[model samples]
Every structure is written in C-alpha cells, then in structure tokens.
Target: MIATLIKLLIGLLLWVGLAIVAARIVFALPRVQDRIDSTALDPADVGPLAATLRVRARGQEGKTGIAMLRDGADAFAARIMLADAATASIDAQYYIWHDDLTGYLLLDALARAAERGVRVRLLLDDNGTSRLDAELAELDAHPNAEVRLYNPFNLRRFKLASYAFDFFRLNRRMHNKSFTIDGRVTILGGRNIGDGYFGTGPAALYVDLDALAVGRVVPEVSADFDRYWAAPCVHPVGPILGQARRDGAIEDGLAHYADDPQLEEYLEILEGSEIVTRLSAGDLDLEWTEAALISDSPAKGEGAARREDLLSARLLKAVARIESRFDGISPYFVPGRAGARAFKALRKRGVSVRMLTNSLEATDVLPVHAGYTSKRGTLLRRGVKLYELRRKSASRTPADTLGRFGSSGASLHAKTFAVDGKRIFVGSFNFDPRSTMLNTEMGLLIESAAFAGNLHDAFDRELDGLAWRVEMDGLKTVWIDPESGEVTRDEPGTTFARRVVLRVIGWLPVEWLL
Candidate 1:
C-alpha cells in the first residue's frame, strides 16, 4: 500500500510537470508574445449622418453634444439604431459581450451593416467573451466586418492551461467600452454588451448609465479607439481563433429576426423611443459642453506605459481642480490603503467626499464586495460618506424595454462621479485596483455643472430610496435604511449561504485580482 501511494504521487507530479511545459510551449507559439499592426480607415463622409450632424453643429465649434441614457432600454435602442443608420464605418470595443438576446441582436445589426458596404470593427476582450468563438469568427470572415481580440488566450479550449502559463499578462484586460458609427457619433459608459447590463438576462440586472456623444468628442473618441486598435496586445481573430466555417444563417445571408416575438417587442420600443427619431432628424436634445477623454494607454497592459498615460493620473489631475464636493459612483469599489489616505486628505481639506457602490446583498461579484468591505471602515472613519445600493425589483422595468435580455435590478454597474458639482465623468472605470493597475479604462470628463449637479441631486433625493447608508458605531459597522430610518447590524438582504461565500473569499489574499 505504501509503494502504491508513492507511485500515485509520482504519476501526479509527472502529469503536472508535463502540463505546465505544454502550456508554456503553446503560449509562446502564438501571437501573444508578438505585435500585429493594422491601420484603421478614416471616418467616411456618410451622407445623411454627416449632413444632419453638420447642420446641428453649425455654430458649435470645438464642443461636444452629449445626451444621457439612464434607461436601459434607451441605451440598447441607441446602439441598435446607430448600427442600422451607419453608412460608412463602425468601431466598437467592449470587455464583455454575452452570447444572449441583446448580444445577438447587436451582432445582427453589425452583420446587416456589413452587408450594406459599411466598415464594421469589433474589438472585444477575450476574458468576458466566452462561448462567442464561432460567432466572432463568422463576423470576422465577412469582407466588410473585422474582429480583433485583446489580450487573448491562445489555448482557447484549455483556458486553465493558458492561465497557468501566462497568468500575469492574462490578468490585465482592456475594460474600455465605446461604440462609434460613421465617425460622427459615439455611445460610451459603464455598460458592456450583455443582457444584465441592459436589464434583461438570467443574471441580475445592473444599474447602469451611458452617454451618446457627438461633435468634437467624437473625433477624440475615434482617435483614442485607433490607438487601442493598433496596440501590440491586440490580435486578429484569424491568427488566434482560426477561420470559421461560414454556415447556417451567415452563409445563406438570412434576414434579421424582425418577426420573432422576442425581438419584435424591442423593435416596437425602439420605434417609440425619442433617441432614434430625433437623432436621425438632427434635432436630438443634446447639451453642448467642453468634454475631455481620460484613458489609460494600451501599453499599460504590458506594464510599459508612462505614468502620465494612466487614467488614474488624469483623474487625480481632474480631482485636484475640484473645490468642495465629490461623488464617486462605482459598482466595484475597492479603495486600497493608498486611496483611503487620498480620500482622508481630501476630507481634511473640506471636500465632502461621497461614494455609492453595491451592497453585499446587491453585488453580483461577491469577491469584489469582500475587497470593498476591507476599506469601508477606513473610508467611513476618515469622513467619506458611503452608500450601498439595494437589490431592487422589476416593477419599474418594462418587459418589452429589456426584452428577453432583461434582468432584475440586483446590482450597481454604473461607473461615474461628480466633481465639485461642476465636472462629471461617465465610463467603464471602476474605483478599484484592477481598474487602476490591471486594466485599461476610458471615460469623458465634461465641464458642465448641470450634468454634475444631476448626479449630486440624485444622490440626495432618488438614491435615498434605492441605496442604504453605511455608518460606523464606534468601531462596529452598520447599515442604515434611509427610507424607514431603520438600522441593521449586519449586511442587509444577505443570506446565510452568501455570507459564508463572502467570508471564505474575504480570507483569501486575492485583493490584487479584485
């Protein structure tokens, strides 16, 4: 029995050693260690799109026209409509694009746009886009459509092996989300391409926000996208995923599912939405403002980026310009010791620093919540006000609005903040270490008191009903329900099983990964 046990241990060791060797060999064989270069086409003079936008901006030079898309349905509609309207080029990049209702819907629009001779480019991080290999390959095969994967995994089938070999590089991701069409309009913010983001899916819904932008910012957005598109970490689908067999609907070039009951409802909602109609007519109600894009360099993933190229540095510069109040909204809030000290300094200087993030009960990524909990005491003790969003019901959400892709409002996903009630930021940046050091992020910093005040106002009024306040009773933490003035000693709406998961993950030394 002792000899048999020794043999078993030897066999396991041999297998593990062989697996590691194979993984490293596979990782080096691909373009993961190499750079691919490609040039992006200039924004075409897309007839009606440019003509109408030009008329609208006849007098507004060097200013961006921005419109808020707080409603999930409106955000979804805006993307679909823009895709359909594009006659020149489309550039879209995202961290997550689920293989669900909304994902397919948007892909269909892109494929249709490609059929009509429009240039379509889709750049997605390989991390969050599992089970999308076949569809992505098909899209890439299209003459007018191209797809690129960022920081991709070479061992597609054996992801574990890939991670084992290249965990350091794979850990960093491109978390930027932006969609530009005809080089004239762009939609950007916290939402990824997923059902939960748009309020539909089996997963819990995300409280999200997006901004449809045009004018001066569009060029900036396009230029920034070009930099990422030409980054060394990016790879074409052909080299990594290989060629896909053009079959089924893609081969036959079938028509869209306009008649499908699931898609029809959303089409009806789009027809009724004011965004698409006003956008096409050049009469969209957009606020003109001076907007600056803050983004991390594509080189950040390789740890070779300059400090000045980081989004955090740009944000700190922006924050330095603030005087009185600051409201930071992030679903994944993991303020490390450094962030705590910074906030403490801000507090000492009389800045009313407030933050809104997911509560334990409302957070979908429980591990992130664990990381956030570690800093709560430090932040609250240092005079930073914290609000945790509650898991909300679907009473306010419409079935048709989200379609089959909708979800219950169970988490906060919007990453935005108001600075001194004069400047506001909205984008895919989360206030966590991952966003700071492990991922590339982008957002618009608008110099508009009105837009910034809207966020501050919501925190004072609407958020009181949607979120609970986190306070400290000496050294003990408690949650206060603002609506009923009820205080709870433990996390609100959390189950015993979930608490166990949270505790287990909290004990793990994985704060850097969060």
Candidate 2:
C-alpha cells in the first residue's frame, strides 16, 4: 500500500509539471499576434492651450512652469480640467485604474475629450485593470480614442494563472504614471487612478504630489509617452478584447457623478480652484525651474533592460550630487541590506539623511513593512533618522493647512526625495528592490531649492506633529509619538495577528520580491 501511495504521488507531480508546460505553450500563442502601433501628434498648431503655454513660457526657454498638487482633491481637478482644456491630444498612462468612482470619472472625462476630437491615448498595466474590460472598450470605441495594455495576460478571468505559468515575465510591471495634454503641459507623480489615491471612496485618501508642468519638459513627457506606446509589449485593446460595443456607460457615469449630491462639495472645490483656469489663461503661479526627466528603458518590462538605461542608475547619479542633506518619503520603503549600506555611506559623508515611511499599521502592503523592518535596526545604528507616519482618524487636521502632501490619517503613498536642499526627485519610485530591479519607473529631477526646501521643512517641522520618530533601544525597537512623546515597544496600531503575519513573512526569503 505504501508503494502504491508513493507511485500515486509521483504521478500527480508529473501531471502538474505537464499542466504548467501546457499553460506556458498556450500563453506563447497570444504573444505573437499583431497589434497596432502609434505615435504622438506633432504640436505645430495645438490650438489655444498650446498658445497659452507658449506665451507663458516665452522667457524661460529651458525652464518648466511647475505648480505642486499637494491636495488629493486638487489633483483630481487638474486632470479633469486638462481634459477639458486640451484642443489637440491627451496622453495618459498609469499602473492602476480601478473600476471605481474616481476611475470612471477620469475615464468619462477622457471619453468626452475624445468626443470633442481631441486624440486620447490610454495605456495601462494589465495587472491593475483586471475587471475594467467593458469600460476600456467604451473609450476605445470612440474615433479619436485608443487603449492599450502593457505586458498583458492572455487569461481574461484567471490572470493569476498566467503568472503561475509565466511568473518571470509577468513579475515585472510598468509603474510609470504621467498625463500630457496638447503637447504643452503634463502632470507626473505618484498617484494612480483610484478612489484611494484621490479624496473619495470608502478608504482613507492618499496625500500625494504631482507637478503640473509646461515648457521644455512637456515635449519630453510626450516623447516618453510615445516610446511606451510603441513598445514591443503593448497590445491594442481593440484587437485583444474585440471592438467592444459603445454602451453609454461612460456618458451616463459622468452624468451620475454630476448629479450625485455627495460629490457636489468636490465639484464646488474644482469650480473654485484656479490652477486649471490659470493654466488656460496663462498666468498660474508657477516656479520656473531647470529640470530633466529620468526614466527606465521600456526593455525593463521584459527583464532585458541595461544598468545604465535604468532609473536606478540615473537616480544614483542624482543622489551622488548630495552634499548636505537628504529628505524623502516613500510609502513602500523596503531597503534591503545593500540599501542600508548606501544610507550608511551617505551618513559617512555627513549628509543629514531623514526618511518618512508608512508605519506597519498604516502600510497597505503588509509584507513590505516586514521588508522594511528587516533593515530598520541597521539603518538606525548607522545614524540615519527614521520617521513613520502614524494612522489617525480621517478628519481634517493642522496638516490640511500645512501643505501636507499626505494628509493626516492617510497612508504614505508619495515617493519623493530631496538632495542638498537644491534638487528634488519626484514620481512613482519606491526605495525597494522591486523598483530598483524589476519595475519600469520615471520622474523629474528638478533643480529647485524652494521645492527641495519644502521637503526638508517637512522633516524639520511638519512631520513633528504627523509622524513618530523610530529609535533603537538596546536590541528592542521603539517608536516615540511625535505629538505626545508616548513610547511603544510594539508596532503601533497593528493587531497581534498582523504582527504574526509580518514575523512569518520576514522569515521567508522574499525580501527581493517585496
């Protein structure tokens, strides 16, 4: 009977192996199918918005006009206003476009722009758009609109199954986020298209940052969008999902949002907000600054990207320019052993390094908190200052008036760092192994002391009321509440079960993946 059981186990293993092999073969078949390729339109006569940008950018030939979008409500309004103001084209790409209220709002806005004859190109990473087939199809059905999915999975319903068979390829993702309009203005930052990122939905909202830019960097963003659009991995949704019927979902969705009394307050905020109106009128209060765009090559999506072509490599060069101070905020900050060493090196050079990340109870991804905890002690011992944003009730606080890029009672989702109080980098880059080695990322490296000073000021003043300073107490880790000076030995705001999960996860050899 034992011999029979052993034989049966062997047979089961053989069948499982065969099934994986068959799945791989099936996945390969869809990859070879042809898809459409396109590029951004030339901005010779991009109408009123382009003219307004040109007039505003007349003196600063090389500088980009930038306005910081610190509030979530303002961020949502800026995108909608850009869609309304664009006369020529609108290009947008994001990792996550949830099938929720804010997602539909933005989709409806984009669809409306396409209806007005403004070309709209939407590219989304397939991993994030799992249940939005019909919505994407609605926009794609419009004459001037097109949608593409990056590194898509063939399995429509069971996309995770594709990962089981082809984990290596699907593991890497396009985490880049940008929105460009009329080839003259753009907004690039950490926020994704979801109710959570914006100030809506059931969950607590994110305190995020986006730079509304014009002048030299606008074309640079447009060009980058074109490169990602024409990449080998992109598949046109029209061919993959078929020419989806033009159900009036997008139109009716916008109408619902307009009539919904709950969103009326937000609508009033948008109507009263002056950024987009100023953008159209060419007189927004913009800091003119020298900036350069840095991004990973599209090849990173396929694990074939070269070291020099990566955002990590370029980011290293930027950090090397740091002579005095470094202040940063990253939501998922999983600095492994090597990263801790890098921070140690920075400390050796007398750079005042400070970081603010999500506390264990505040982080959305539990495993990432474990990844950070693994290196927490090493960083503290090396003289680096660490602060963890604490969770609170979702109510308006002093931070609401302090230009807190992240609000009180919000998760830390913004990824940004300032160097030497004169240069700052902002976009969708977390200081983790995944961002360094797997995902394609992008951001702006700006030579603006004022902007960098804002980040430094947060560490010096604003965070005192908003974050807990983490310290090493012998072999025990302790958190000191910034506002109350209360001490805690345990991970604040997390339950016993959550702590167990982190402990179990930390024991696994998965730091690189985190």
The numbered model that scores best in lDDT is 2
Task: Tell me how candidate 1 scores on lDDT.
Answer: 0.81
The TM-score that candidate 1 achieves is 0.90
TM-score of each: 0.90, 0.94
Residue 337 accuracy (lDDT) in model 2:
81
Candidate 1 residue 396 C-alpha distance from true site, Å: 6.4
CA-lDDT, candidates in order:
0.81, 0.82
CA lDDT, candidate 2, residue 45: 65
- Tens digit of lDDT per residue, candidate 2, span 324-357? 8988888899889888988998899898999988
- Name model 1 segments beyond 4 Å from true: 1-19, 27-29, 32-40, 201-203, 249-261, 393-408, 495-501
Candidate 2 RMSD computed on C-alpha atoms after optimal superposition onto the true structure: 2.4
Task: Give residue 91's lDDT in candidate 2 (0 to 100).
Answer: 95
Clashes of each: 7, 1
TM-score for candidate 2: 0.94
